[model samples]
Structures are given as structure tokens and as C-alpha cells.
Target: MTVNIDKLTITTPAATSSTNLVALELSGAQAIERFPQYVTVLSDGSVKLTAPTKGASSKSTHRTRCEWSEPTNWTLASAADHWNRQRMTVTKVNSAQKVVISQIHVRGDDSPPVKVFWNKGNITMGFRTKYNQTTPVNSTVLKGVPLGAEFTVSIHATSKGVVTVEAKCNGVSGSSGALQLDATWGTRLFEFHGGVYNQVDYTNSTPAADGSICVISDLSLSHS
Candidate 1:
């Protein structure tokens, strides 16, 4: 399906902010406020997100991104009654560092309960129900793909709050079985995000001259 650029929103770090924690949304009325620095849309319709080595502050020196979201907000009550799906590929990862490439988040939640990551030389998909849990959903690691390689990842949420995750790379694929959502998430809204979210801090040290660049293509979101 063709994606509607007008309905998509791009978020990145703000240029001038004291807290160094504000994000600039590119699309809404705020689009005119400041031009996006880390996120950009290519002429071919793909999205690219860059994470600088050093950011606004030490607390978090990186940027978070979402490819797109469903127009209508959804909650657990609507579970079993509605569905949300997201798909994207990791076209190019400039570095071998770990990065959050996608997530399924509940509104108001500081962090997404479900996240997909590119770690070292492998792909890891994890999930959590608690805000303070240190461990993620236990699962086997999926082999990594090289540059120009394509990986299709998707998630399907049922009306009963059951979430299913699937991924495909080089003709091999696997599933997360069924992940039961926490009851606490029942009343909260949820959405899908796809793009690079650097997991490292570059403050007071130097790892790579160029932080990292994550390119995602064939991004599409749909719900019913």
C-alpha cells in the first residue's frame, strides 16, 4: 500500500532548548517552528534518522524516532475489536553499535513496552510489562543482516490485548508466539514506531567520529 506523507509525522531533537529534552514534530503546526536536524524524508519516500555522537545533554545524548502511526488512537478495551500493524526494513546501519530500531508503545509510558534492536551483529526483539523491569522478554537472537539487506518486521495486536511479533530476514523468519499485554495498559493508547534510536552515550568520550545512521525503507502502518 502507498503511504500518505501528509499523515506521517517526523520527530527529532529540538535545536535550542535548555533541558535538551524537547522533541520537534515535523508536520503539524509546529513544523514551521524549526527545521528537523536528525530526521529526513527522501525523495523515494524512505525515512532516515541520524544519532549524533553528542547531544543536548548527558542524561540522554540521542534521538528517538517513529516511522508513522495509526490515525485513530487505540486502547485495550478496543482489543479483540481492532488491530494495528507496522512494517519496515533496516536498509543500512552505519555502525555495529546497538540501536532501537522499532517499538510498540503505550501512550504516557516513558518507554515502549516492546522494542526491536540491532545489537552488535545480531537482531534482538524484546518486550517488557513493568516500568522498572531490567530484563526483556526472553527470546532467541535472530541472525543479523548486512548492509543493503532487508528485514521485514511486523506486529499484530488483537482485541484481547494479545500481541504477536514476526520477522523475516534472508528467507528465514520467526514469531514471538503470543505476548499477553499487562492489564495496566488497558486504558492507555498505543502506537507503532520504526527508526533508529541510538542506545549509547557519546559524552566525555569518543567512539566513532560519525555517531551512526539508520536508514529505514518500505515503512508502512495500518490499523482497523
Candidate 2:
């Protein structure tokens, strides 16, 4: 008898002009309509994202981010569990302020269950429980990640609202211990977000000169 094993492979589809692109604003009445020039999808399946000083809305000034959501409008309440992973590199940072690399958030909640950020030339991952909250209740998980370096980031959440974060940089790896979720989070829906989200606020007289550029080669998600 003879047996053979089959090989498996996965590929990213080429992006086109009509790709479903979405943007989120921390505060504003108008929704971002058009895809900005700063975002580009390369032929090699890598996405280049640049956060400019001026974002979509003028009512509030902060870094803008675009995320890929399946079905264009799925919410957190739509699923019981969530998982996401990505391989990315930071190419440029205009300032020392923290810039969000990715996040797992619920609809209408200002704060996300997990967020990965680059701050002062280091990587900081945090978990937040409360809804509409700005700060993470837990401490940073991984730090000291070098800029311009390639890294992997992941997030997982159970149906019970237990959350965890995994990260690897320069062959060093770590994970965030299980974080209990706030009761409010379970009442809403969630989504995965990636790109550059600057944490600094802009002023009228002096607009934010801070911006960041990131290249994401791989991004995956699953929910049940």
C-alpha cells in the first residue's frame, strides 16, 4: 500500500478600486467616504497605510485608520468568539507619540478589548474591559519592540469575554494573561482594525505633525 500527502497553500487576492474600505472616527458626525491617498495595496499582497496629520473629520483631530471588514458591516454582537493575526512592519513614525498598529473593538465603544501600539520606539500591548473608556485597565504586555522591525501580533477572545494577546518581535515572544471582560462589552458587537492610529490630539494653531506608516503583509480573522 502507498500513501501520499497533499500540500496546502493560501494566497491573497489582488485588491481593486471597489474593495470594501471602511474608516472610523473617534468623534464626528460625518462618515469618511473616500479612500485616502495614503493607503495603497501593492501587487505583492502587502498593504501600505499612512496616517496623515489631517484626518477625515474636522470636528475632532486624531490619527485616522482604515480597516477591512467582511460583509462590510459585521458587528461584535454577531459572534461569540473572535481571533485575528497579522504580520507587519513599521516603516516610519513622525513623532514619539503612540501609534496604534491594530485593535479588536466593539461597536459604539471608544475603547477596544485589545490594542497594539508603538510608543517612543517601543511596542506596547494593552487590554481594556470597560466600554466607551479611553484607557486600558491592565498594564502593557510587551515592550521595547524596535522600530523598522518585522513583528507578529494576534488577539483572541472567548465567548465568556476572556481575552488574550500574543506578540513576537526579533524572535522574542510573549502573551498577555487572561483579561476578564467588562459586562458592558458583551452587550455590543466588535470588529478588527489595523493601520496607523495616532494617539495624539491636534490643535487648531499647531496641527499634529506626527504620522506613521505601516506595511501589513498578512492579516487573518476567524469567528464562531
Tens digits of lDDT, candidate 1, 34-144: 444565555766555565544532233344333344434666566453433334554444343666776776676555667877666566778876643567775644676
> Candidate 1, after superposition: displacement of residue 33 in Å?
11
Task: Report residue 60 deviation for candidate 2 (angstroms).
Answer: 4.5
Residue-wise C-alpha lDDT for candidate 2, range 1-224, written one tens digit per residue: 11010110101111222442223332111112123345555667576667754444222334454334333334455668778777888887755567777677566546667787777766677776777778776456567677788888888877788888888888888788788787877666666766677666544543445566787777777787
Model 1: runs farther than 4 Å from truth?
Answer: 1-5, 16-21, 28-37, 57-72, 79-96, 130-134
Model 1 backbone overlap count: 4
RMSD to the true structure for each prediction, in A, is: 3.8, 8.9
TM-score of each: 0.76, 0.73
Off by over 4 Å in 2: 1-36, 58-61, 66-80, 204-209
- Evaluated against the true structure, the overall lDDT of model 1 is 0.58
Tell me the TM-score of model 2: 0.73
Clashing pairs in 1: 79-159, 80-158, 80-159, 80-160
Best by TM-score: 1
